[model samples]
Target chain A: MSTTLTPKSSPIDSPDLRAWKSASGGGDTSQPPGLLSGAFLQETLAMTRRLFIQLQRRPSTLVAGVIQPLIWLFLFGALFQNVPQGLFGESSNYGQFLAAGIIVFTAFGGALNAGLPVMFDREFGFLNRFLVAPLASRYSIVVASAIFIAALSIVQTAAVITLSAFLGAGWPDPLGLALVVLILLTLVLGVTALSLGLTFALPGHIELIAVIFVTNLPLLFASTALVPLDFMPGWLQVVASLNPLTYAIEPIRYLYLHPDWSLGSVVLQSPWGSISLGVCLAVLIGFCAIALLAIQPLLRRRIA
Target chain B: MPPAVLIEKLKKSYGSVEAVKDVSLTIQPGEIFGLLGPNGAGKTTTIRCLCTLASPDSGNIEINGTSVVDDPKVARQSLGYIAQEVALDPVLTGRELLQLQADIYHIPRKVSRDRIPQMIDLLELTDWADKKTGTYSGGLKKRLDLALGLLHQPEVLVLDEPTVGLDIETRSAVWQFLRQLKAAGTTVLITSHYLEEVDALADRVAIIDNGVVIAAGTPNELKDRIGGDRITLRIREFTPDDEARSAQEMLARLPFVQEVIINSAQGNSLNLVVEPQSDALLSVQQSLKEAGLSTFGISQSRPSLDDVYLAATGRTLMDAELAAVGTRNLKKERKEAMKGT
Candidate 1:
């Protein structure tokens, strides 16, 4: 690149490149050829910044994200307020139990929408602009989206946590609150990867929305978010046990109820066996790993 | 010096439909090269392949001697592409979008700092730079699109149907900008279906038809190769078929007239291919009057790029464009467009 840069300075140079030759002053066209070069970081942050700007201007998604979970905690809690206390494993009220569910579900729903902007960009031909540019790595496209969704999921999780605290859904200790964020981030990462995978794998936004629709409600109901695992009959017990959301919600709910919890504390007693909080976090991590690994082929086909 | 942009036997297909086939062009530095064709004539496909938005089934595409397929990053750095559809983030102001463009191209901040505003001023987009792209008028969008493409000051600028839907005022503005870019030594590759667009801007052109290059040269070279002048004679604004046929026959019998065709789609206007430097225009006018038919409009001049297209394809560009409309599946094409093909 340095070798070629000399020509722009020569007398017989092409016209109009005066700005280009100088504007490119030192950062030449050739990149460092490493994945984490200055160029890679710059492009990723720029793309991420674009997403942030979008969220800042038209914040309907953020507003709705906060409101939806609040509605679940208040409205749905009132609907089930009369449930006998202690029928759901020592929680003084349904709101206490349902808080964990609302938080996890809200994060899950937000993660599911990670792909919509990208799909729209693809449909509108904006993604092609990225594809054609000398990007350090196309993975920045996915990472930018993951970062945006993760941030939004955290905000939504905060709202659910705060409102639940007012409803006597006991707040976790400092360590416990950190655990909740860790669990939520893991869950968001896994779900966001899958959503972005669907964005590239599916033909268009309509098909993607269809997949999200079919999976959204059924997963919520099947998970232990709204009810204890023991409340379900035999087959549903097994189904809820298999659900990833159950693993996330149980540990977080345990954090709220038992502030002195350790990694060895039992979080979920599935139909098969008792699972510790450490095991639950391990399962969420594993789920996230699988989701990330699963999307490689699709990402390669679409973006690379 | 290597050609500023080069392609050899490039071909790409979407499912079963071939978008580009056997297209090859070599553009030198500081010249404007046009890929002129109808809507589905493989112009955009070829550009897509060259720009690395779409991969080719088989062929070699290069920029400044670097193989695009092998080292696309370097090729991309050398080329800037303006797609037919100006896809901008509605929420981002024009300045924001330009900044993104600069970052993606990895332009130095110090350089882009001095440059982005320079480009905004050059493209007359400073007033609209702070506004969201969604509120921009069609012309404003196009100018911003041009500004985005030129921001990095790439060596080769590829514009796919640059002014397709612009008002004439903006179209001329873009044309004038391209000419200045060429004078400044940027290699420009533009694709257009408009006859005057290519004739007005291209230093050389490749006439693509149905995924193949049927003719290529400077516009005048192509026009001269077809070896005749064009004379359009409309007996009336909407002449009947019989009247057109009679006019065609009378024009064909003239000593200097080489060929005559009745353009039925254009109200049966008679198109004549006459010997160069001949007095056939006056004779045809005299004959029409002698035949007791008043000429509604009669014009004769050197063969246009469209005449070259006609001579090669046996159909005028307008006819080919109209024909391309029916067989083209719009939904399928839009889907392909999303794939950036």
Candidate 2:
């Protein structure tokens, strides 16, 4: 048998040796490894590896994730192909105008669904595997999911950006590309945090799916994904202005239209005020911070 | 020295139903301890509390003398728990799953590389280790679960119904593995409703019923405490009550016989509790012949653990199991299982 077997002789000759050997063997030792300890990093990496392995084996989620956004890009671009130039912003073509929205929305949608797998884990009792481990921090679970979802969002955004270029939605300059990645990352972090929060808060997968179902399409419609904020009614304009998705979308849209875009560039002209690029990025950062802060108690209750 | 595991006055409830109430147990180091109980008798709940998966409403759970409620991470590190239901992610291969487990336990890269193969070999899972667990048979899945549980080599290995749905061969293999584990000086705590599973494996047993430990001792100690050799005498196949009563009456007069009950449930078989003596079996047969009631079949043996349970709980384990079926709230139980500490 490959399994290591200890001899019948007792391993514990002294208290200190017993404690050291027990802890090294992953035996139940009495003290918690200190907070932010190496054990936390090991557990988080291991959990994140499991997610990656699942994604690799079941590649459908990845395939569909990329495919869904591309379909949105092609169909929505065709729908507005005949519209007059400059109607939706400074872009000469509608496809160019839609690229930024699709990039932001694709990452947003992917990040929003990040909690589904976690919710399923909870329902299926897989989370208990982690809960029972002597993890340094239970936040490792949340961190792993966030990291995996962020990586997936980055990949999907890259694909959407490449495909948009093929459809003649002009590419952003080198710095513009960097800004675009930053924006998608910020949006993903916040949305991923919210999704993970839902995973811990929701009772089961059915309830989570229902919540995702309602949030997915409505957020797209209300944001500047399919339509510019200037085109919406007075009430929807206010709603869109408040939507975090709009903040992510408008800055990317501004980047696509102006290669010389800086933080001072006006991204959206709301009824209340003109939102600057720096303000948009700050809103996204703030949204992520709040989303993370909001889920703390939920994670603590479940993990502690 | 502290026991390998100690649970004291552990209480937990789901809404109105108390799943576990005042459960106290102390399992010494390196012994195979069995928690025997009918369904809904709080065996799983007790295990859950010890494993740090669920917090007790009020109790102290210690793993190797460290408090579970106060230092759950340390308690968790000390124990390896295999739940009743296997929870492998179908998408990941068995090797990947074990790797994940090794990581969660913070097994070093070198140790994990060495240990994973050893576990696969120990469980006879080398052939199936690379396949997704979703495709594994029940036995194979269980073997993999056992591997995962043992990967960390925890001092106290806690399993809940380890072989509940396994085939006879698989169950035997698991029993053998547990014995091997015990030989290696690892403390094992297992819960099972199967009478023979406990009787055949446990070094010591605690019989729990209705959220409490009704009896606890070595199996022989409990059986011996009940006291008396049990003789089941069938006067004839499908013996009539009058004949059984007459035989029972005749048996009652014997000086060595302590008690007599006519079991009409089993064809009026006269159950006799007699003092252990050299001629006890022969005297019962001789008395039946004298009464002119032909002996159909008769067997005499020491009192079993069931008799001990019956003596303490006023009902057989089978009867308790049947009664528990109606009252078991499976949905409520599942929700409770999902509730983390």
Candidate 3:
């Protein structure tokens, strides 16, 4: 049963529509087309734009990310204000000592929660939209979260650094400040990758949240974020030495104490040995590399 | 060109559940091919396999001659999928969502520039296109989803339950839009448990039951195969059981009567299937009168798609749908859909 067609209703009659029709040719092929074209960049940018749009519409994440750290910087700095000046060592005051901890932990916290949005996407069936499309790489989903979280962490670090200065913690030199930013970036990248990996590996958001809840504050206290390794027992020092955050924290703390810092400046005194600035940077870089590498198999298993 | 879509012995299982035991259908280009099934009959599973969202344990799925399993990117490029649920980003406006879809499909900037507006106009979405999807009504969200799926102008547009939850007006609008698409030479694949939706729209249909295709043919061909006319008779509104039984007995004695069932749920109406005859209704009424029965109402019509389903499966689509509701593990299905493998 054929119905009469109206010329005005047919899209093919439009010149631009006809051009689009020819541009997307009818097809059949042995293999799918993915990499050798610009579809990868196009899809990645779209995914990233979606995340940023979400952030813009609901700015609470960034707002809370910035404010939560200020609470820690102010309250914790005051709690230890009565401590002897030399008790924490190198730093002249409690605010100065707490500045480095707050910066690293704030950045870490922001990055660590990066997986929540992706988890929500999975739970809400939104990720299926990406999965069904011909994406060049599914890791674009993960990378988009990393990019958004990195931008957010930078903002939080700026807030914490500004507050710390007002609390009498002197500013690092320009070079030192740049290093601090670099360290925060490194930490955020690694943690965000790990968190996103958990998003895929865990069964659901509830489980991912459970994993995050368990991993968050313990890692913070176990590291050099709140207290110096010198104040901890021998066993605790070893634990702090092994925590990735400690490696991130010690360098920033060193920069705060000594503005004349160099790549060779000593950053941490672990139970095993003293760690220098160059080694701390190497460890942070290595941590980021390993975290990324470890999640590759998980991402491939799900999205490939 | 090859058929717009083809599946050969497609089978997929989630652990112990065979979500798609076996399914295969060929959809010719420029026609609306429908997959009609109940909730747990594996319609979505089949669509998932074809869309490259879920890989079949064993079988082949092709879109426009491209094997979805072996060459998914090519298959994906050829198919624009609108999922059963409109999975739009709530924060993104309708236009932005379409743009994102355009980018994902790698539609060129120039094409999308003109094409997006064309789609908005065609779907009559101009006024609401700038609003965030969160603010859109269900119908508006569905329209935007349709636009997103059509943005790249894929050769085959696959929609899972295009109007499962829609107002009557919007549903008709969608039906009209689909007809226009076919007129414009675009092949469409849609799955629906709504019998009328498939019957009214599909050029051809495959009725899947319990993960296997029970029947496949044009709607008219399937109905004709049943070889009967349906007659509904009501002695009274909510007729008494004894009267319904007597009516069933009288109708069964007719030489042309094939089957008669008392539908208590529908005011105890008597549903009869009989060989097509011009005097079928008159003969039934005469027999009822001879049995001292007074007909409150009587209507005869050609067999519907549901009758064809009953002939093949020994149960109406509504019965199967009700039965399926008891057994469908929706949580598991959602998880299985989300899992790529």
TM-scores of all candidate predictions against the true structure: 0.90, 0.91, 0.92
Question: How much is B163 displaced in model 1, in angstroms?
Answer: 0.9
**Residue-wise lDDT of candidate 3 within B1-341, one digit each (tens)?**
79999999999887678989989999999999999988889888888888877778998888877788877777777888898888778899988988888888777777778778877876667788888989888888888888888877888999999998887767877887787777678899999999999999999999999899999999999998878899999999789998899789878988999999999998889999889989999999999889899999999988998888888889989999888885878887666555555
Model 2 C-alpha lDDT per residue in residues B1-341, reported as the tens digit of each score:
99998888889876677888778888999899999988889998888778776678898888888898887777777788998988889988889999999888888888788778877866778788898899988888888998898888888899999999987667777887787777767899999998899999999999998788889999999989999999998878999888888888888999999999988789999889999898899999998888787989999998988888889988888899899887777987776556544
The docking quality of candidate 1, as DockQ, is 0.30
Instruction: Give a tens-digit lDDT track for model 1, residues B1-341.
Output: 99998899999888778888799999988899999999999998888878877778899998999998888888888888898999999999999999999888787788788888877766667678899999998888887888888777788999999988987767776787777678777899999999999999999999999999999999888988989888988999999888888878877888888989887778888888888765678899999899889899999989989889988999889989889888999799767655532
Off by over 4 Å in 1: A1-22, A25-28, A32-34, A302-304, B233-251, B262-270, B278-299, B336-341
- Give lDDT per model, in order: 0.85, 0.83, 0.83
lDDT accuracy of residue B174 in candidate 1: 77
Instruction: State the DockQ of every prediction.
Output: 0.30, 0.38, 0.33
- Per-chain TM-score of chain A in candidate 1 equals 0.90
What's the residue-level lDDT of B142 in candidate 1? 86
| Candidate 1 local lDDT, A1-304, one digit each (tens) | 1211122233223444455544444236655344678887888889999999998998987898789889889999999999987888968899999999999998899888888889999888898888888888776777778788878888888888889889888788999989999998899888988998898888799999999999999999999999999898989999999999999999999999897799999988888899999999999999999998898777655331
Off by over 4 Å in 3: A1-38, A302-304, B335-340
Task: Give the alpha carbon lDDT tens digit for every residue of A108-160 in model 3.
Answer: 88788888888887787677777677777666776777778778878888888
- The per-residue C-alpha lDDT of model 2 at residue A25 equals 59
- Answer with 1 or 2, whichever has the higher lDDT: 1
The predicted structure with the larger lDDT, 1 or 3, is 1
Candidate 3: which docking quality band?
acceptable
